[model samples]
Target chain A: MDNHLFLPILMPLIGAALAVVAGQRRMLARTIVLLATLANLGYGTWLLWLVDAEGRQATQSGDWAAPFGITLVADGLSALMLIVAALLMLTTLIYSFATLDGDQERFFYYPLLLALLAGVSGAFITGDLFNLYVWFEVMLVASFGLLTLGGSRGQLEGGLKYVVLNLIGSTSFLIGAGLIYGVAGTLNMAHLGERLTTIQEPSLVTAIAGLFLFAFGAKAAIFPLFFWLPTSYHTPPVAVTAIFSGLMTKVGVYSLYRVFGLIFPNELARFAPLILTLAGLTMVIGVIGAVAQTDIRRILSFHIVSQIGYAIMGLGLASVAGLAAGILFIAHVMIVKTALFFIGGAAERIYGTAELKKMGGLAKREPLLATFWLIGILSLAGIPPLSGFFGKLALLQAGVAQQAWLITGVAAGVSILTLFSMLKIWNEVFWKKAYTDVSQLPRVPAGLMIPGAVLALASVALGLGAAPLADYSALAAGQAFDVSGYVVDVCGVAGCDAAATTVRQENTQ
Target chain B: MTLILSLVVGTLFAGAVYLMLRRSVVKLILGLILLSHGVNLLIFLMGDGLRRGEPAFVDSVTGAVSANAADPLIQALILTAIVISFGLITFIMSLAYRANQAVQSDDLDDMTLTDKL
Candidate 1:
């Protein structure tokens, strides 16, 4: 049963090795990646079902036992993230085919892609802290290859800054994990959570938590630490940028949720104030930067930071409702953001540029593409009956409930700015008359259009089916907010019992 | 002993930071190497100052835990981190080399085409 949890991580890793060995065979590599991603999606659905039916699943690899050996656990939040990642991987693999040329496909694209997918899945499901860091390294290295593969001067420059900043994040993550292990006498996340229940040194734990905040904060691209994102993210090829826009920073956000939500619950009170302040600042700065950008991908890249602010704000609220909102909004942003990038990519392809000024008359040239763009735009703006609406509504409702007046106001303001920039894209890329000599422009291929169309439809369907999604998110949120059950599931009943007794004793005192 | 080790870590970190702030990409890579070494040493010191004299090895016959064994988990962790950082530094070195060759400069300030607002 626990082995079922391993498949999502394993399948991609095995496929990556196989595809790398089958290098230069574009047809074979593409087929391998697409099939592996599809298999992963199916496996993700299965794992979600099992978690839904059986509750959080747990397994300690090699029978070394809990708090001693490596553990893999998947609860509601992990499963939800897993399924979304699988779906994104599947869609983007197909999307890459349409975007990457034959030479690019054979340039280890499929291998690096599968490796990244594996790393992300491994991060989502791992039950140990150090393992999460290891998975992050895996994901980071693959991303570096993909980001710099073209060896263009711009890509190399961008990749340099990216690696420099990311290595700092990685080092901090390792140091944090080490510190936690030393102070808490455990490396297992469940064990750490259990041990931290009655922490005598709250400041020490909070200091470690601050390190994680820096580590994950940089990865998630929050404000004051987000310079690397807009600079480098726009330099990658469209497929690479689109998927990075979707998944990479969210790994940071997810880690933030995990570390704060579970292992450092005792430190949250001391840290929440700083987190809320950062969330507000990240949102304001991200969208304001986006508003000033003229390039389509560059604008979308800035909005990624701003949207991340909303995701973390939920955690900053530190309530069950807030976490549910954060998780829901995270999934919604991942889908909608990917679709927007695809729309931007398609527009860039048509005009042979990402500059909004040079692009126009897409509405006249391609009505279907325009409709897809509108759905993404509307969803991003939180228009009703769209996925983004529910995501924002839940978050806003949570903020109002918490009486977080300032952050909530900033969030609302950012939403308007988001809509305005998105409109700039629509007006310049589609709604306006053709500004360029487009006679030489090729027709927008169905391949490029279909990926965005599918994701755009998913955004709408996510909205239409928001009820079930909200229910799942609420269940996941419950699992995140109170993680004693996760501790028991991973570390066994004995560890949880000891932690519970400590908690009870502390409460009575 | 712990104080002395922490001072070493601090000095390494300071040096790494100073190097990382320079304009040359090679300095940045050197800083990164020092940064990683500083972190690895920090992790070593973080593991409770290495009390035991030998590696933690269980008895073959009785399967009993070694009484005087060190905390091997952190050592394992540092080993893994070393390997990972080794790969990373190589990648960064090559990336820096590539950027230098392509742009005809190693100074980050000169690579301003991608940084425009």
Candidate 2:
């Protein structure tokens, strides 16, 4: 019944509408976007407080009861994601203010950015499957606009692939939804979880599971489905790339976590071994690709694929600890990756190129920028006492506990390869003698640096706060495992004790 | 009825896979369109072959519902899917057109790896 749950979603949509109307007026657009995103961050903080106070929160939209009408549900995981997304959005907006100007900003960038936020928030909060689809479309449409904002040769090329692959993914999602509805006779996620528990058709369920995996896999950029990402993600402007790198793909992972943990737990268990194998391959292959790349942005983009493998590997373990590790790693990756991209943007701004070979000796002149970049890279390489280390530690522990030795080995190997890639960038860009004498390069503005620094700081903060975050992740994982809470929140019903008991036992164990 | 739906899905999948392998971007777009239609129809048919049930709502004056309701929810969902697919198709087509204009070729291979990276 609390109205606070809707603010994070509604405020962004309102802002987007207003910003669109204020298009081309640079100051007005920037002011509206910044105020709106900041407001979203503030409301997100308030929502976090409410979640902390109430344990979990759910709201039925328009006073309609659940199951029949749309419901916005905010549990611990949703709240955490909203907070992360809001923080990233706010910082990315500031970064954009410094990076984009004239025609670019005037062409509705702020409004589209706000729309993207609304879509993401909506996706995180929505309880209905159909509603999830709608939110996805909202996000995708905005992404389409943002990805092609620059309309460069590379942007268009990459954007075409991105759009096509994702269209197929969306189509598959629709087909899967239809099949699930056919079998279960409901589109509400909680109701589906309740009814799907007893389905006797194994093959049919497997087919549906495959569809969901394909749809989400493309979005998350896992293994064979990830070829589009490295090329395409490097094309956008820095702010666009930073936010997309930070939040969008993670939304895919989030959906995977949500669907598999809540509605398709048995299917997930059945498919864990397969997922583990793919994850191992994904990590190894992605990093190898990174190693082959000379371009800084492209290398970083490939790392995103490799890092996603670690998250999926954690999910593949299908254990509470594993899921917890996945959630924690997702948060860490969002922060570290965004910061790295912002640094890349800054480097590009300084050198007029993203090619590592063309750049050298940045540390001598821009020590502060170099320090921020170093922190991001070290954290990305999973240095101990950094956020990345704890994420991997949890995942590796889960892998060992689950007897997934191959996955553990590959995960560790990827970390090494990741270090090699980071060192390559360091040697070429930061430590080597100046190639083009960018000592005269323009100073990176405070606006952009501050956002990157905030994310860099968050990476350290997450590492220091690991214990409490891990506990929270475990609770969210518990909720993920037990469908009864979700079902109760969505359907306002109380009779599904058997499933709840099983979930509780599994989580406790 | 279900068999017919499966046939349509199979054809669509076949066409889509075939088109996806082709080098022409336009053909690929066509393949996607066929795939989308096939998927949309498959989803529509998944509702267990339209029942001989009444439409979702009944008129009080007539005291009767439509003879073949066919799951209005699925139909409505299918309509939404159609709209979404149409939008995607339009966007993809425009992208292809723009790519052709910029690269001066309809074949994807015309854009070399040297230029791409």
Q: Which candidate number maximizes DockQ? A: 1
Clashes of 1: 0
Maximum-lDDT candidate: 1
Runs in model 2 with CA error above 4 Å? Answer: A493-509, B51-53, B58-68, B112-117
Indicate the TM-score of model 2. 0.94
lDDT of 2 by residue, A195-230 (tens): 889887867988998889899899999998998888
- Among incorrect, acceptable, medium and high, the docking class of model 1 is medium
The lDDT of each candidate is 0.88, 0.85
Calculate DockQ per candidate and list them.
0.54, 0.41
Residue B75, candidate 2: alpha-carbon lDDT: 83
Q: What is the TM-score of model 1 when looking only at chain B? A: 0.91
> Across residues B32-94, which tens digit of lDDT does each residue of candidate 2 receive?
989988888887787746665455675566544454656777887888888888887898888
What TM-score does prediction 1 earn? 0.97
